[model samples]
Target chain A: MKFIVEDAGAYLQIKVTEARIDAAIATPFKDKLREIVVKHRKPVHLDMANVTFMDSSGLGAMIAVRKSLPDNLAIVLCAMTPNVERVFRLTRMDRVFDIRPDAIQKEANE
Target chain B: MRLKAVVPPKTQPMFHRVLDADPVVVRATLTDMRHRFARDVCDDTLGRLELVMAELMNNVAEHAPVATSDRLPVIHLCIVRHQAGLACALADDGVSLPDACMLPRSLPPAIADNLPEGGFGWFLVQNLTQALCYYRASSRNYLAFNIPFMEREDENLS
Candidate 1:
């Protein structure tokens, strides 16, 4: 349930440190991330590079976080590993969220 | 007496484990299972196998019959590699699996406002597996399925 959060002014950049988001930690992971997003009141840029595995419970947690936010606010998932991405693709949750291959580099581009 | 000729192990890899029905235990078993067959299978097929196993095992853990005895259900898992795919068999002393789980299924509707947070586990299992079958006998539930290798254009070349 570890995450590195950075305030990027307009959005919160979160890097998930855990290697696997499975049934063991999905509930707490959802609760902690939800609290972080609710407190910031801004868009989210989730860096998922370290998550090598994610089960349906983990996917459920991600969906719960998405549902927690207001419609105007967005959560952009980034740098998904192949295993994590497979669950989303197989279950069609890929259509629900915006997933990127790399972490947001809004500052570097500017 | 004549010296015995040396014999080699079986050509295909196999894995077996018996453990309590718990999420942490299931995760550890899956990790070990992946390492056991990682060299034998391609990434796509292995990924599919892992996902299906996780979904099945976790479903058992999540739905442990609470009103029964306080002991946790025990699960026996066995996997064997074949030329066509990986064959997986799991038996658990948990509650009988719901009939709906084994039937053909579809994903929950993707409603825009109220998105589905659950109900995707069995759907993924059914989608990724082949020849899936289940039966309950003598207070134990048994499930068996095959995860076929993904078709590759270059397969014939190799």
Candidate 2:
């Protein structure tokens, strides 16, 4: 559930620090991300490079967060590992979410 | 003096664990199980196995009937590496699994306005594993399935 959210003026960039998003952290992860997105009211770019594993529960949490956002705002998933990517691909959620292949470069932002 | 020939140990890899039906414990068990056969199986196969196991085990944790005491339901899980696939068996003393889970399932329809958050667990479980079977005996539920190994490119060529 450890994530660092940076306010990038026009949008927000979130880097999830945890290695696995399983049933253990899915609820809190959804709640926290939903809170951040609702408060900021900005498009979000979720950096999922660190997450090596995600189950159906984790995918459900991500879907919940997506549903919480305003119609105009977007949640873009970035740099998902193979394990995390498999869940989305198998469930066909990849078609629903805006998924990008590049990681949010921390150094370029600074 | 004639000495008997030494017997070599079993070479196949396997894993077994007994844990409470809790999300945290389920996560740890899946991680350890991956490491147990990481060398024997490829990552593609292991990842599929891990996902199926997580979905099945977490369902038990999420659906544990309300108990008067603080005790959690118990789950027993075992996995063995086979020639063509990884065989998995799980038994839990939780509520009886719904009959619909074992039936053929498709992904929840993707509605544009309001997407479904849940209902994807059993779909993923049914999609990833082969010969999935379930039964309830006594007070425990039993589930068994196999995750077939991905056919390697070299194997396909040969």
Candidate 3:
């Protein structure tokens, strides 16, 4: 799984570059995100614009990442493709994390 | 029962494959199917099919019993273009879900501190398909469902 990490002032933005996030990449993705979270100690804004597909494993990985974070630090997901967003909604993860329709604009406005 | 009867006779010919229960093979098969049927179905339906297949095949790869030989266990997948949508049937000679691991009717509670890391596979599959059925017969697990050729806008995130 490829990710482009950016250190925004308020949050650490990580853009996932893969088209599909499944069981194959779930573990590595979670581990990488955990490392970044621990190092930055800032709120994470995951950019899912490039991800066209996500399965339950992918959803679980995101949740695992959230669980691993400090209570004060938040992980926000943004710009999810329709399909990826569906998985989140179906699993009700939308309620668990802060999901933004457009993270770029949200970040810019912040 | 003949597998051809899964879809009506007037529909397109069925696409079938027997693949090793491996994640890489599952990914390749779905990619090939997407390309082959790109022109035949809408993007939404195709995407749903892809998600469902990924969940099912990956489940097999992860939890299914492995063969003792050098080769791994196998799964049979058959798909056909139906009048309403696409019909799919998958069979695998793997261990069935234990009594405690049956499919859930509702989504798990979304708690940030204690979020669940698994158990979302069959839930998504059930939510995305119609007339879903699962049963074990003759030491094989059979799963069949239909994906309608329409976009699912019911759970919009906006």
True contacts kept of each: 0.88, 0.88, 0.88
Model 1 / residue B30 / CA error / Å: 0.7
Q: Tell me the whole-model lDDT of each prediction, alpha carbons only.
A: 0.89, 0.88, 0.81
Worst 10 contiguous positions by lDDT, candidate 1 chain B: B149-158
Q: What is the DockQ of each candidate?
A: 0.83, 0.82, 0.79
The Cα error of candidate 1 at residue B78, in Å, is 0.4
- The predicted structure with the larger TM-score, 2 or 3, is 2
Of 1 and 3, the candidate ranking higher by TM-score? 1
* Candidate that scores best on TM-score: 1
Ranking by DockQ: 1, 2, 3
lDDT (10s digit) by residue, model 1, range A1-110: 67899998878999999988889899999999999989888999999998998988999999999999865698999999899998899888898899988866878643
TM-score versus the correct structure, for each prediction: 0.93, 0.91, 0.86
Worst 10 residues of 2 chain B by lDDT: B149-158
Better of 2 and 3 by lDDT: 2
DockQ of 3: 0.79
Worst 10 residues of 3 chain A by lDDT: A101-110
